[model samples]
Target: MEDDVRDDALDLLAEVLVWRLAGDRWRAVERALDGLAAAGGDTDAFREVLHDLELAGPARAVRIEDVAVLPVPEPVRERINQLVHTLEGPGRAEDDPE
Candidate 1:
């Protein structure tokens, strides 16, 4: 039940980010989405991001003059940050064997 709520919230956030984001932020969002996918984030949203990337063709780094400034609510902002942190996970050494 709790996990469902989390997934739902992340899905909603992903939906919002997908439609509202533009410019350089799109690249960051794409990376974050990729990390989220690796971190076991929502499948539906992840699939959508993958589809979007496919439609967008090869990923290229670019910067344009116009950039959208998304005004996220505090709670939503915090939640998104938390999700990214979860995606980041523990700070472990690359060569460290568990």
Candidate 2:
């Protein structure tokens, strides 16, 4: 049961990270994370998961791109594409948004 809860927490964190990188909006991610944390999940761990997602490159980049095409800001789309390219090794991390 505890392991199931932990997995659910991690899944929520992954979803929130993907949504943020896909340009869903900060408030949306914050609200969702807050809800997950309220459900006994560690907020800090969720944040770490988000950080790891950003660093994972290939897998996470593809996930970002798959969601990034749906009515996002142009700048966000550009950033996602840049991250994908960086993951693909055609661009440098310096080109990424901080």
Candidate 3:
């Protein structure tokens, strides 16, 4: 049950980030998602990120500038950051040995 809630929140956060991230941040974010997938860390979250990345490009193809400037509410950004930290897991840096 706890895992489900985490996964769901991670999914929503990933989706929001894919669309809301400013400038070229999405590239690094995509790379992070790829790295997470390669490391087999949270398959569900990886899939969610991929799904949102797929939609994000075309969804903002025309109004890219407008969407780039669209403000993400402060609360949502904070929650997303919290979910990202949870996804990273405690005492588990990217270089840490499993």
Candidate 4:
């Protein structure tokens, strides 16, 4: 039951990410993230799910300016990249040792 709930939450977050990215709305993304967090989901976990969605190729990537009208910081981008790597799992990356 816990696993099911977690998956459902993550799936919702992924959908929200795709929606926000499609509409080029960073504020919407942030609001969705906050709502998820308030509902007992981890914000960082949702961010990771967003990265995974991007990696899975269903979500379109947008320029920082397209989303926020300003440059997104590199650290945040790196965090997203790291989330993708983490969610993609071991042995999924060609360079992964496992």
Q: Could you say which candidate leads in TM-score?
A: 3
Residue-by-residue lDDT tens digits, candidate 3, 1-98: 14664466466556665465554544544454454445345566656655554444424344545455444446445545754674658543353432
What C-alpha lDDT, on a 0 to 100 scale, does residue 39 get in candidate 4? 38
Better of 1 and 4 by lDDT: 1
Off by over 4 Å in 1: 1-5, 41-64, 67-98
lDDT per residue for candidate 1 within 44-94, as digits (tens), equals: 665555445434322354345444444433544544556545533444223
Candidate 2 lDDT, 70-97, residue by residue in tens: 3333554444454334333434545666
What is the Cα-based lDDT of residue 45 in candidate 3? 68
Residue-level lDDT of model 4, residues 7-95, one tens digit each, is: 55445444433332333344444444444334333556655644544443323655555654433334334433443343345444345
Local lDDT at 36 for model 2: 36
Per-model TM-score on C-alpha atoms: 0.32, 0.30, 0.34, 0.31
Best lDDT among the predictions, by candidate number = 3
What does candidate 4 score on TM? 0.31
**What is the alpha-carbon lDDT for the whole of candidate 2?**
0.42
lDDT of 3 at 38: 53
The collision pairs in model 2 are: none
Indicate the TM-score of model 2.
0.30
- The whole-model lDDT of each prediction reads 0.46, 0.42, 0.51, 0.42
Candidate 3's C-alpha runs over 4 A off are 1-46, 57-60, 63-69, 91-98
Q: Using alpha carbons, what is the TM-score of model 3?
A: 0.34
Give per-residue lDDT, candidate 2, residue 69: 37
